[model samples]
Target: MQTGYADHLNLLCDMGELISVLRDSDDIHMFLDQTVALVARHLKAQVCSIYLYDESAERLVLRATMGLRAEAVGVVSMAAGEGLVGRVFDSLQPLCTGECRIHPDYLYFSEAGEDQLLSFLAVPIHRGAVRIGVLVVQHEQADSFGDMDVRALRATASQLGSALENARLLLSLGGGAEGSAGLFQARTPSLSLVRGKAASPGCAMGPALILGMHRCDILRDEAEPERSGGMACFHAALDKTLAELNALQERFARRLPESASLIFTAHFMMLKDPSFRRRIEEKINLGLSPMAAVRAAAGHYIAIFASSSHAYIREKVSDIEDLACRLLRNLKPGEGKDAEGVKNGGIALAGELFPSDVLKLVSEDVTGIVLVSGGLTSHVAILCRSLQIPLVIVEESGVLRIPEGTPLLVDGAAGNLYVRPDDSIREPFVRTQAAWSAAESFTGTMSESTWSRDGGRVRLFANINLLSEVPLAIRSRAEGIGLYRSEFPFLIRSAFPTETEQYQVYRRLFAAMPDRVVTIRTLDAGGEKVLSHVDSAGESNPELGLRSIRFSLLHRDVFEAQIRAILRAAEGSVCPRIMFPMISSLDEFREARSIVYDCMTALEKEGISYHSAPQIGMMVELPAALELIEDFAEEADFFSIGTNDLVQYMLAVDRSNPRVAHYYQPWHPSVLRALARIGKAGRAAGVDVSVCGEMAHEPALIPFLLGVGIRTLSLDPQFMPAVQQQIQTMDLREAEEHARELLGMSSIASVASYIGVEKRA
Candidate 1:
């Protein structure tokens, strides 16, 4: 309506020209140059550079630079925490540093002539929580950019990400060797692959499906639920929900897995959790959709239960949240259907599916089905794999954009997926499967420590959670249980499990591991581990909020229960080592150890059977914890570095955050440096440092970790055989040399490229 406002609108529309130029470009290189030229002039910046994470190099490779030397492009790679660029990678937050050198975090790379320095701004280009690349601009003049500049840069960054993904896809389609950038790195695994029970079953064909899932935006920009005003309406919705409760539950039952169904009863109690009800009232008062209101309420419920610092409370809400996610995912599909062009023989892909959707497609004439969802243990995954369907969940974003049928392949054992695969790819899998079977047959009844030609050994272990998991773990022939998370069974139960009940469960677990050294982890809750009983206080960010040891300290009784239960389960046998979670401070670990001592003392007073001395440890998952490694290495008996949380906390990039998850590189130099530092510290202190994080499952990283002085590796049973086999063939001396070389590198991408193994056979 305003005259000058129209001109401003026109200036914005003029950006369409730059967008057109970017669209025409086929690779990330050309697009960056044009983007810098197009936006720098508008933003009043003298220099604009685009840095992308080189997956292989593990570094932020400068792809295109303006007002800099031509040789500088592609030659420079910054560590994830190198400079302003590195800090942006580390934090996943946009920054506008006025005096670049003055910033403590800044690491200057020298090549960009000093004249082009001063004010700096950078925004991460992310596909969900993963930061794929970064867009940065600097000017000779200080104080050059304000909020508007950052906003424009962010908007541009998003477009750049999409463009980069598209270009990579195009390259893949064109059969370019550079196309590997879009695919997850695969190793030419030399390890004897072990077989495990397929949990979520599904058969798929078309593309190896991976969903482009961003982190759930738990932090919505909407008003906080507690401040909303429509409670009476919420009550009415609650009443209506009750009227259809039976039918709703039946539908929900149809929508969830039987394992998940065990927690259905909690859905009822969840609707009753005072916190849950309060969230509903808050949302209803706000006049939001009852479902939206419910979800917001559930988010709050999940947040509290998730951070209860108590495993029992955390487990109590797992299924309830699952049911809610099922409900939410179901409702969302009906909102809009953005169907793309389906290839002649392409199949539909989705992540873990709602049971209703499963039934609908059970008999459909789909070329093949690819689920973007479904964990290995989920019913759908089991069913599909049993059917030998070419489905691949966790395939990154394969399911999202896997164009109809151009040809694809999935080698699940190796976690390799190929899109538009050559027809010949299948032949190798058939052969690999046979080789896997032979390896199994040859190694069956095998009882030998995994050892290399030079006599070096790599310990192989299994991950266990419940008594029900014993059979699976034992069947995997794992020598010992690497991680026994005591939260799952407790979470699924209706009420607090009694001490005897806990003993029975633990007894069953240990009984299965007669000769194995089982390392038991105390309840790891917080950020989704919602305990059903205790009310976990809400914090700004649950991931960084009260969790693990932080929660244990705040909830001493809960911690005592777990400690006593473990002692009781030991029943005087040499108990496995017990490790506390998220120990960032020495006092927290000390308090936890004191509490464990208190539990032991209580047992002693009762004259109950228990190990007189059991190994006690803490997870080095926090940076502050890393800072005190020498102190803890001396105090604690052993250390199990939770690489996932460690990397997340160290880098300040929550892997779950969708917007910046791409930037989460386990091999990032800073993370590697920290890992290497701890690995060395643990080795020097004679501490057994074993990693049970998802990264442990990556065979490529195993050697890297080991070379950094991590001899003990605890991983999932299925992956252990292959990793074990690889270790047997590897020269520890060489591996350590490679790791040392990588440690000296500047970027995670480069380290990954250099250290990550490939499957050539």
Candidate 2:
């Protein structure tokens, strides 16, 4: 093994020990003191201290120390951002430097007796995204800390933050006047407010429907207990939980975007980790019930993750908590369910929810969802958006303290949840909801022909993934179906949907649209959406690998079945159009087209009464597709710009990855230029061009699309009215001028400013 790899493994082992110490300790002061001492020993540093932020005072007080004078522990305090230690907490990043005493930002505290220290390292300790404290280590020698040493210190700080928060919570509960009884009493005001990321956009006012909480009672002592039976029970519950997770993963993979299904995969991996399983087994052997063992083990990891400063790592706590709950409930069935008094139409409140839990809320017809723990990109959040249900993630612990059935108002657009909102606040939200409903009704009545103020006409189409959405498309009066994702039926089914089954589905979709054009993109499944029956090793980076047209061509039987079905569906009245997705090169598109031709010939030989060959097109999603647009325009019947993937590929950013999602800009000058190039190519070849990505729904981008000469747009049915409103208000000439100016802009901020300035005018 490489020396660096060995060193990393050793560091991880040490971190595990540090975590054990934090989890086992109960006293806050002793825990803090031991943490500083252990950190000083681990790094071979001369001094280590922990400074916790006092929110009320707006300063960091020295809570624990190893090398400082004993008297300085409680007395030493610095204003936030005033000293080296404070700066770490304020910036939420680590700082390491030699000759720290000479730095411009250094502030020496005489009482701490640290004048001799030359090298210093400080890392912020946080609970998830919230800053809590700073962990500092100092050395008498210059340049004492290396990169590895800094990393070790940071990991220790994360554990310390979580442990401290847990200790504080216990302290509050134990020290209160009413002791444990005080825990149930609401600490938050009657009119409380909390903010979270807006997973979906809408507004609703209803009573809070709190979900049932899971609890496990640990039996600490039982002499001569049945250890083997407890272990057996624990393992059985673990197996069941894993099975449930696998099923949930598959369900989410079918119903939601590929990114949304990853949480379950992560949970599955966590469950399989030997160390985690061992921890639960150890607890089981200690005479605890099977459910208690699972809860205890989960809590240990949850506390460690909950204290982390990194949002990504901290988010894992929720997943772990959910898994623990599932294990407990599996061990004792019918334990976790909705509270008895929960009524329909109320906003659902929960500490966390799995994808299945959210589906239950949908069945109950809940008006909104407020989760105390969940990320904006979680599967449940995605499901809520698809169901068009408002969801808000409340981060404050006080949210749990709010009484069940409390009148709550959820502002999903603003990411705010109000507890017992007054008449003044509720009145405006009611009006807003009414306005939205009226807008939807008015948009449904809009004419099928969409025209700009300057008489430039654009065909508004609907993007549908399922047959259920066809009615909404019809109601919106869309001229045609722009992009009908044909992968949904395949994804949702347990096995490959038979050729007859696919034909029937296509027949239904074609019949629904009738004479209106229906562009069905051939099964674009691969990458994140893998078939269970396919024998394939998953790609390291699936996005750029075997997907879309490539997958269809490789799996010829599947491709042939879909093509035959599409052709048969077009027999009499339906004018079906077939579009191939993720086509980067002309050869790939040609190969896919040849398969369709082969299918048509086979249908003719079989005496199948199939209609004429449909208009074949390619989805312009890759940067390579844009470059070869003119070449493709020669043979292709039409080109639909999938701005979602195109922008991501052009910018080299994964939109689903939170770290770089901000860089996935549709307004980027390069993306605009590419779109314009495709538009020119399509117009020159007399091929119809359209955009069917989320960009089509954005009203701000409608003018730009018109300016780029795109004459057709396919989007969600709900967005048609607003986009039509924006289009009707626009003058084609002014839009072209604005588009030209926007293309000249260098940055996203500049383009946004230009648009904002124009909107005000």
Candidate 3:
């Protein structure tokens, strides 16, 4: 609002006009060089520099400069919050100082020749929540910069945000293929090993199928008049993409588990989102063609998603790009053929893969995937795991440039990739592969009951996540369903499912396994598995905060609705058991049970047919419940040992945190003691006890569990045969003797050493 500020604003606008006239063919480095020179001239400053944030390194890299030494352009860099530029970026505010040497956060670099520089002004450059970089100006004289200077620099940076983002995206996508020589760096595969994160656990050996090599040239921002039929063309493509997604979702639901099928639901939601459509429409209204409009809109979303610190949010970038690519393919057929050359029984090598792309690979029977972008917990990685496909995330982008048909062996369990391996590597993996294939055939029939050599029977149940997995459980010969995670349905949806919707899902679950016990856990929606629709946010430590049974009690209406759905869905079912998770106290268990009774009563008053006496149980997963097992057993009908949470809570380690994941040992002495104590208490009180966590399916721990009197074991359906085979190999007497010796040990190392197979030698 000052006269000088108004004049400076006009100057910034003039700089924007100059930037707008620049063409797509202009080099990004040239543009940055010109912009900095113009800013220095306009502001009458000694130096002006542009520092961009490199997300992978978490550093502010100096990209261009006007007055500093030319060599320092790419060499000078600092970590976020390491210097004055970082302080401005961290605070997202303009910073000006008259005496740069006296400032506490000032960082000096000799290569920049800024020792004599006294006046400094910096402003954070960002678009919405995305932090792009920082723009700074310097002067030789003290107090040379003023308020007008800061305001002008800030305005100029704002105008540069969009152009910089577009340029960056174009450069990254376009620089890969200079010609055939650069694209095909290696004609013959070299012997080498690359390491990455293990996404899904398995081994795969096959020829590599290179993908994502096509650089669609639709991202250029050139002047083009809007076509007359652009809206119609856009709508036709939109409908086709939606249809393709629907078919994909249906195919996955029919063939894969519900979790894998729901990966496409986000695609469907985005296509139907009003805001996404509005963005494209706005671009079209601005005289751009339909294809260009979609690209511009998608590029905006991709930039925002790629800038996020949260891994989950950042994963959305692929989904957005996939949608745009699909739309462009529909808009103009035959172009952007990135996946055209893929074949069956091959390994997919790419920079990154979308969720739909993963499903397509599964359909084509691709053996494994080697990605340069995805994390272990990403949606595509989860889909690969659910589909039993091997996936490894490597940092080696050169794999994309490797010749087609290169023999690549992926060790998903070890996170290693062997390129054109010799017999030394091939022979062992071949034997392992043959042995795995033979074992996976699962010669044992599912109808036969499993028993130890000492004649103690052990029941095997399936831990179901969705209704689609019920058939898998039945085919695997699981006697019943245990630990049905009730939170997954809530997690996938944008809003809480209504009672009718919940009842329908539950009905399908019970109808699939008639006359068999199905232990459905109540809403365990907190901690790491927070519901998007619920107001359970801002907890510093969510694992110890309102979660599990505590969360169910706090939101009693949600608990009762879920209870009512379960009760109503179990009208004709013989054995439907309701279980509560994370019960830390006696009062929590009592309150949850009281709510179950209230739901039953309310259903009866409404003249609805419902089960009156579904069995109630509690998961003994906390140390408090482990120590006071007798008290909980006295009040509860049965106990399910949720070993995943029990081990995490008892050891005070976040199993999901990679830094402390090693400390989450289920084989620890105290964890074993707690399991043994719970089994003893349950037997004393005549309460049926079951192990329904990951510990149940572990082949090494099955004997120990039976020794501790845990007769019922629940696990993933895929592991049922292996656990059954392990049970058949063990004698209950030997297991009991081993359990006695193991529980007597005080140290974890002693327990591990005593049970280790090498110790027997």
Candidate 4:
């Protein structure tokens, strides 16, 4: 039994080397030939053959062999369940027999020269649920294989699955065995161009800094170390990681959105969570070293979260990984890597970067990022945009194969990436880079208010995410603060911020825009903007479940605290408005408004100076609210069109889902009608109506919005110059006529076609 364990350890060590070889191998066919020969030698088997499933043909074709006739490698094939090898593939299980000739599923291939084999052992190779191929060995002597041999071959087959899958993907991308070297290692590789979504718009040229390659190493469940004080070492590291997270959060608090900076808050919460701690402690009790225990516990969560279909849940995988890395770094301080020294002024190439990793990479002064795989709505992309880092996300694996320090030019606006671009490509971007820099400075060219060519005026307000954005809004000459997402403070805190704590934040926002109207939206938590302390984690359909105003109402104590803070903060401010989000019914609106009034009355009774009658508003996000716009216009002081959710709910499409992202059309006739209806109703009722969603900043949609009588447009401060320019070029009368024409269109395609022609005209 002791010798069996020794043999297994030796087998694992040998297999690890083989896995490394497969990763670095340029020619997959050559690697397979070497794999067969080496496995035959290791197992002392006469025959070692590899059969790869041809997906298109639905047959298992012999790909490599060590002891069979070499010419029969590609010639021998069989359907699943047609032979011993086929039966293994069909069952997805290992098969071992002393006599294979008389087996029920046996079929002979004369060219293979395998008739002499009396003993057989075959194992299926797969990646996840995907069937890749089969691995088999045979001996002329009966009963030559045992359970140990079956386990050994099974382990080898498992390692081959991933390498074979990568090869298959490469072949599908036109990288055949002969062309693999040219595609990856040539002076000017033909397959070096990659197109992806432009998460942040800008140009950057630099070498590639590959990240996340050693991610699997973090998940390895190694045995206990031969050292005392393992538990003490782990506690020290955990404490140090917490301190680092807090420091980083505070350091970048002024530069990033509270939500973005507080990304580390999730790490802190995970550390404090009993389950995470318990899991680690349990592993340690079971004789794992503290370092190994931490990894094992983290790996459990990472695997579960990464397998989720929901993008939000999957994104948590990165957070957990970042935390694990931080803990590991603290455990072994000298092992810490300095990104600045290794790849400063380079573009980071990663599978996916968590938000914390984004901050780290940016601090190292990396020029930009190329994500070989990631979602569009990843917080990493958001951080890149906020930090003004150029970012492009591609679906290609070839980007990962680029040699370290290879120059890459990223055209983030066009979503184009050129590997090792020549001077011709660099010259245009270099010339434009200076101009782009100058353009972003925005030297007060536009006036405070935007007016069309025909002199119809529109009020352009800034949607402020944090107090840091105030200077930018003031610089852009925004008319007012149309929307201030009030959830940021709540999102970043481990516990809910107290009323006074909330007041201080609100006071800064109100003071920043002293003369302009500041519309503060109440806690819009849940949905995608989840609160860290909330109990909404297990909700299967969170988007449609308790969220937004529902979350605020369900926890009235929390809602009342926020409202009281807003009232207290509004003291001495010229115009402060409070808005409620996701109001589906009049009762929901009435109930929320009653809570605000209740808070105001409580402040009055307590002799606390407060803004008694700040303008109360409702966000027009739900389809039900759209239908009842007239009723809402009468009760609500203003209507802020939250078109992001409006379009999503109206079309029944999750905007973040790439599969249905195209279907989430704000230009849909139904959405246009809804916007028009709300605009007309607000006008009829003498109430202010503004659009504060992504549609507001989109220059092309400005005319349609203006013609629909949406006089107030709220958008990100960065878009002010372009939006001002677009408005200045438009004639309001022409815009009105265009809006009329658009309303008559029944389909999104027609609206698009009409707009295309109108632009040309």
Candidate 5:
């Protein structure tokens, strides 16, 4: 921001070219030497060094020094909280001393005989939250690192964070750092650097931690007169690296202990298989190092594989494709963003942030971001989704084709990113904008007793995980929470949350809606919500396997913790509705209700004031559950039709598997017949019935659901108003006639088409 500060940054950037070849180091000392020299040259410092956090020893070891003694390299180690470097490591914060001697927090570790120390700056190189180490810049002339120097160093430190995070994960994925812990950590946004379109509109800018230049010896064979002349030595080096990669892949495959994530295995299998390796060999025959050749070939083929293969391929190929892409990015030219621009007030746009770009995504001031290269469940995408940031992935054609910093639009709901739209293109979006505005306006006209106009009162409840969604729910004016998927906290947490931790989350969530009912589903452990740390049971088919009620039935302690917290969170005032998933029989309900009673008994024993009676419900998903619904109807308070699973099960289709996914029709007369049967069965016994499948938003299914005596619908909050409008327009007689006529139809498609006829018409 200052004239002098600008000069300092420019000087540092200018010095990047000098160390272009220093990246060939395999030794830590070499890396430290190159790093210090680069810093000293860039800052015009008389003294410069790097202090690394030796986590095992709990100290900062002076790795490389410019003006300090030679003996300080490995001998000088201090506690993480002991000295200047230690303080930075402990705090994970940068400190600048304009006058080193007068600085109160400054603690000197080395006995520099006669070196004058005037100014100083040190910053932590963090992958995400953990401070891996610190980078130090010093000068004999005092006050070298001013406010400007501090800012630049901090920015540089971020670059280090980004690079290391990317390098570790990518290398780990590529089969290099095989046994390292490559856990999923959410990217926190830097308050100082805002990402906008720099040279690209569609591309999202993550942390730009460019290592400036390659540090390792990536050999490039000179164009030889004959390919066979130096072939033996070349092949020997290639074989060794390939061996290294295989070992890496094996380690990775072993690290993935979760059941049935075949993609990870496929990645390792590919590395070991000859077909993929032969492609690299072919590239090497044309003179590339086997390492670079394998990476390049892998990128090309894997991209093709991901693009052409089955939906299962996408998930399975994630580890492989992600590894390939990261290696490609690192091998390519440039770092951070190629061009510069601003948006919502911050630096935006960076070169392709492949899945490996682990940027810090801080909570405040985060609005929108676009990733040119990622999928819906890529580590980055999943993390951002958990953080409630709008992100779009899987648009490779747009990444290269779109211009930099062009006005872009993203619809995270639909997984769509509109790049540089023509003026007329924006006109259609205005209608969507109007719909959003109208939805917002309903915040005042709504409360918990809300229902659709057709006298078919459907609860427009939100499915929430993170607290971030609370604001969106309030803004959307959701009547209550339908499915508070409890797995997200477990998904994001480092370990199984203590009761107190779970209670805190529950308390905050309940406090957010003091009057509204919140239905918190007990932790759905298996299938999609896998907890890596927990010792979950493996199943032949996880979706149908030991998941949901099955998981709860066996793992009682885990189940009890969630149930108790849900009741405790309900406290005295806000009515709480608790539900279980995959309930197959009345016995499971009896067992589940026992757990509920046990939870209540515990609370009563603790003498905490709470609801004596919380409404208990079960997801009527499995066929056995539907068949026995009549038996459990008297025991259960309400039945929220889990149509997502019901349609899949009844149709003999798997919703997640894309192949037969087309057969998953909610309109299928069979599905409607099942719904009518269940809804009517629940209604006859005086049990309230609600439908919560994706079909609740389907205009045609509404009439069928209403016709089935389904009194309540719990659709998404955004769809509630529109659904309500539809319900208010139709009478019970009309819906009954429509359902009776449609039920007689042969196909769900026809029923849907029949429902397509406007009720007003």
Candidate 6:
């Protein structure tokens, strides 16, 4: 074999092994140390080091190293933009240089022992759009690192970022390390304060009602002590769990949005996985008791998912744990009881919570929720937001020692939980609540139409994802429904909802707001939000791949069912507008419209009463859509700019990823330009344009949006009053001038400064 071919094959084998170790390991320190050693050996580099970004300190701290001083692991730190490593993080771009010492940005860290190294290659380790750290490999010889070396480092760096995040979460929850008795351990303090991600924005003070952790004690009896009876018991337990989950799903489906109820469906699917059941059966056949077998099987899968490098997969660990506990409780009847003595207006505290548990608390009149280990995007968080409940998530270690029934103050908006507070501190909270109530009453009396000081008016619409939110929209005095996310019904169900079911939902929405215009957006699923019944296979990049309109068009059966339902519901009442999501091209829009026409024709042939033709629109979320706005405007009735996706795709940032969230700026000069272009094209084509994403509700951005000629703004119902109040105080002429200056600005800092200065004036 040729030497080059032999070397390439060796590289591939090394990478495979490296990735295997990275994926299998759950310890962050171990993973980083192993990574540096592997890279240094495979690439023939003199040194390899990983530096993780410390947000609190705003510096890059050396976390692991190979062929360098071992003592510098946690001590050496560099400010962002301070050295070669900092430059990589600041630029969020790779840097390679044959002459490392001569670089202007180079900073000497004697402990690193890189004095003899010449060639250097550094790549930023990013989790989605967020830059978490930097990976650097140095060689003793100049020009030693090539493109292949850079590529390999980048792949490894990506894996490292994901693994690091998973490990951090595990450590925070006290799940990965040994000798940790509980999820958290709080240090003694005068008044313990636990900080967490703000899931739902609100403030509430109440006594702490700690929910007990339920675990089924496993007996060490011989495996299959009762032989065939053991297998029977396991199967029966599984069946009962599945039935319970189904019942829970049905109950939640009635009250919450279908999306919230989908959590149960996921748990139900897990119980049905053949492999998961087989694992337990194999253990049971080995003479293990059914309960023991179930515990072992669940532990195995939980470890695997918890060690995963992907954030989405890592999150499933919580679900698996929840399932295991439920199954165990089912297997051992009378072993665990549901949370009792939940006081009205109490803040429920738990190490972890499932969607069902959160729903129960809500029903018990629990004022707020505080979790030790739950993601901001979890189903429980979604339910809390929908129910308008305050939710704060603190690290387990921070609040593990707080006593039950202790008076506590939870500020979800600020992401803080006070263990106990004195009257001086608590008094401010009471005053704030009173002031908020006054503001709410005042805004509640305002008219639906919002006008500026300069006599310019903009219609305020509500963006709702669930049919249950219709009344809230009406209460907010919204002029209309700007964007009704039409995917929740499909998302939460075990299978596709029948046309009749879809029609009933749409009819209820129309009935709730008979006088207002309702714009229903078609199913936007298949990316982060996946459907169980749909085939989401073979799409390597779901975000930019078969999602949104692409998924709907490919699955014409589902699309037609939805379209037929919407058409039929609008037959006798005011015709609601239909908007297609993620329309990137004129051809895609036309094809979707064609499908709608076909659905109408089919309904006509069946002699079903339906609105044959209704107002059609497209969401301008993609840069491609912005580029072809003129063509789309000519064919569509109106355009709604989905700024969330528009900014994400345009900036090449994933908004959900914490590392790159800062880059997903709505006020970027380019984003502003795109909005302006869409507004201009809509005006030219005599089409109404609306801003419907979260950006529309931002008070700072509201002035700019209005100034850009977008006369229609849709936002969350909770934000409408605040936005209206801000609008009533703004002058359109001043806003237009501010927007013009903002359009010329290049940085988010500049935009923020302009808004801040204007607000102060």
Best by TM-score: 3
Candidate 5 lDDT by residue in tens digits, 1-761: 12265566675574444333223422234334455655665666756666766655667776566555443455567787776777888898888876766766666542332134667778887877877778887765556666767777776666655554444454355455332332211122111211221111122222222221111112222232222323343345445434544554444234321111221334446556777667767776887754467456755765574454243343334455444433333333331123111223211222233222222222222344554333343445555555445665322211322343445555555555555545565666667667767876775565545544455455567767566577767766677777776765565433556666577677777888888878777777776565544544435566766778877779788788888777777886467888888788888888998998988898898997667788998788778877777887888987878899888888788765655777767777787778888987897899877777787778767777777678666665566666666776778767788788977988655665776742210
What TM-score fits each model? Answer: 0.50, 0.61, 0.69, 0.67, 0.53, 0.64
Q: Give the candidate order by descending lDDT.
A: 4, 3, 6, 2, 1, 5
lDDT of each: 0.62, 0.74, 0.77, 0.78, 0.59, 0.75
After superposition on all C-alphas, the RMSD of every candidate to the true structure, in Å, is 16.4, 13.3, 13.7, 13.7, 25.1, 13.8
Better TM-score candidate (1, 3): 3
Deviation (Å) of 99 in candidate 5: 61
- Superior candidate under lDDT, 2 versus 6: 6
What TM-score should be assigned to candidate 4?
A: 0.67
Across 1-761, the per-residue lDDT of candidate 6 in tens digits comes to: 01133443465566556545545644455556556766676676767888988776788988777655554566689987888999999888899998899999999874454656788899998887887999998876788887777777777677677766655665556444442322112233233466667888788888888673221113212242332458888888788788767766666667764534345655777887889989999999998877788778877887687555454565566577677777766666554244223566689877557666776677678988887555565567766876678999754322433577788888888888888887986899899898778755665687768888778888999899787787777878889899998876675444677788788878778778777789899889867766645555567778988889998899899899999999988875565899999998988999999999999889989999987668999999998888888888899999999999999999999877765777777777799889989998999999999999988988778888888888999988777778888888889888888778988887767776777733111
How well is each residue in 1-761 modelled by candidate 1, as lDDT tens digits? 11133333343455556556545644444445556655665665766778888766778987766555443456568878787787788788999878886888777553444433778889998888877878888876677777767777777777677766766676477666756554333212111111222233332245322222221222232342332324554565455434444454455334322222333456566656787677665665667755577677666666676555564466544455554543343334332122211233445455334332333343333434554334443434533433234444442322343443345554444444455545476676667667757655544544457776578877777776545455545655677877887665444445555566566667666666756687788877767565545455545577777777777788777778778878777664544778888887888888889998999999999998876677888878888988889889999998888888888777778664555887777877888788888888888989888887877877667767878888777776556566767777888888888788888999555676686643211
CA displacement after TM-score superposition, residue 756 of candidate 1 (Å): 4.9
- Number of the predicted model whose lDDT against the real structure is largest: 4
Clashes by residue pair, model 4: none
Task: Kindly list the per-residue Cα lDDT of model 2 for residues 435-518, writing each as its tens digit.
Answer: 778877986679878888889898999998667677878888888899888765564323467688678778877888789899
Query: Residue 437: error of model 6 in Å?
Result: 3.3
Task: Report the lDDT tens digits of candidate 4 across residue range 248-324.
Answer: 67666655545433466668889999999889888878887777787888889987976665645655666787788
Model 5 backbone overlap count: 27
Q: What is the total number of backbone clashes in candidate 2?
A: 1
* Candidate 3 lDDT by residue in tens digits, 1-761: 12265557667777766445444433455566567767876787778898988776789988777676554566689987889999988888999999888999999885565756899999998997899899998887788888788878888888887777766555456565453113212223232787777889889998988874332233333353434457888998899888877766777656654434355656788899999999998888888888888988888987797666554565566577678878876776554354333688888887656667877778778999988654465556766765678899764444665678988899999889889888999899889888765644673465457888778899988898767677767878888998788876576544566677688778878888878988899988777675644655357788898888888788877888899999999989989999999998898888889888888788888999998889999998999988789999899999999999999888899877765887888888889989999999999999999998999977667778888889999998878877888888898999999889888899877777877632211
Over 4 Å off, model 4: 1-191, 195-203, 215-243, 257-261, 266-324, 337-343, 372-398, 410-417, 423-438, 487-504, 526-543, 605-609, 648-673, 730-734, 737-754, 757-761
